[model samples]
Target chain A: DAGVTQSPTHLIKTRGQQVTLRCSPISGHKSVSWYQQVLGQGPQFIFQYYEKEERGRGNFPDRFSARQFPNYSSELNVNALLLGDSALYLCASSLSTGEGYTFGSGTRLTVV
Target chain B: ELKVEQNPLFLSMQEGKNYTIYCNYSTTSDRLYWYRQDPGKSLESLFVLLSNGAVKQEGRLMASLDTKARLSTLHITAAVHDLSATYFCAVSWATSYGKLTFGQGTILTVHP
Candidate 1:
């Protein structure tokens, strides 16, 4: 069975630009969450969605937003990207809340 | 809010050695997860501890959770080069179900 999938694998953007990263959860999964991992650090939670509704948000700023679709897929959007936004954005999927999760390979965003 | 921390942020061990990584959380969540990530890859779930005294093992790795003490541990036996990676322990958010607070990660390097 295919695990969580994300694309594009890597991305590059200029400062003050906008970028969108996409994630397709595993079949039968209904919860999706986003995380940002900077170099030399562990991932920090961003947002979580269940059944197409926003459920939880992390300490990220208003420039970061995400939404889940009916199919349980999710999209993470970052507006006015800054050099500090360059990191691996990971998407994780689970059958429900407080369940085991599977993560995608993640989208590596580098802002110049 | 929950705070998760892992000790000894980095480890280097020779093959055939044994080591243990500790994870501590500030809150009273009963679930914890372990993950491994390569240099440029997303996280791979290693173990999930659901309750106090829960223990799970795979290959040369074992994980246990102690809810009373609010701690989890990952133990490695007979480590090999393939075991080199960053390991993270994450605690489940009680209210958000799928939301997780991750530890700082322990980078393990096993050499022959």
Candidate 2:
């Protein structure tokens, strides 16, 4: 079975631009969550969606947003990107609560 | 807010040596996960520990969780250069099904 898959292995955008990163959860998985990992730092929780509903959100600014589709795929959108926005955006999927998670290779975003 | 911390953020040891990485969380969590990441790569799930006194082992890595103390440890035995990578521990609470707060990550370098 395929694990969680993220799109556009890498991306580059300038400040104040908008970007959208996509993720396809593993088959049979229903929950999707997003995280941001900066250089030399661990990933920070961004948003989590289960059953197409926003379950929780991190401390990120309003410019960052995400949504899940009926098929369990997810998309993370960042508007007005800043240099700090350059980071690896990871997508994780799980079967149920506390059931462990499978992560994607992540989309490396570079905001110049 | 949930806070996850890892001690000895950087560890350098010789091959065939044994070492342990520690993870501590501030909030109550019954589920803890360990993940490994190579340079310029995505996270690979290593272990998922649930409940107190839970222990799991794979290859040269052994992980144990203690819910009462909110601590988890990953021990590497007979380490090799292949084990050189960053290890992260994530904690999940009941309220959020699949949302995880990750630790700072321990970068391990095994020398020959």
Native contacts matched by each model: 0.93, 0.91
Task: List residue ranges in candidate 1 displaced over 4 A.
Answer: none
lDDT of 2 by residue, A5-104 (tens): 9998999999999999999999998889999999999999899898898989989999999999999999999999999999999999988645788889
Error of 1 at B77 (Å): 0.7
**Tens digits of per-residue lDDT for model 2, B17-68:** 9999999999898689999999999999999898899999999999999888
Tens digits of per-residue lDDT for model 1, B1-112? 5689998899999999999999999988857999999999999999988888999999999999999999899999999999999999999857668788899999999999
True contacts kept of 1: 0.93
Interface Cα RMSD of candidate 1: 0.8
Query: Which lDDT value does model 1 have at A31?
Result: 92
Segments of candidate 2 deviating more than 4 angstroms: none
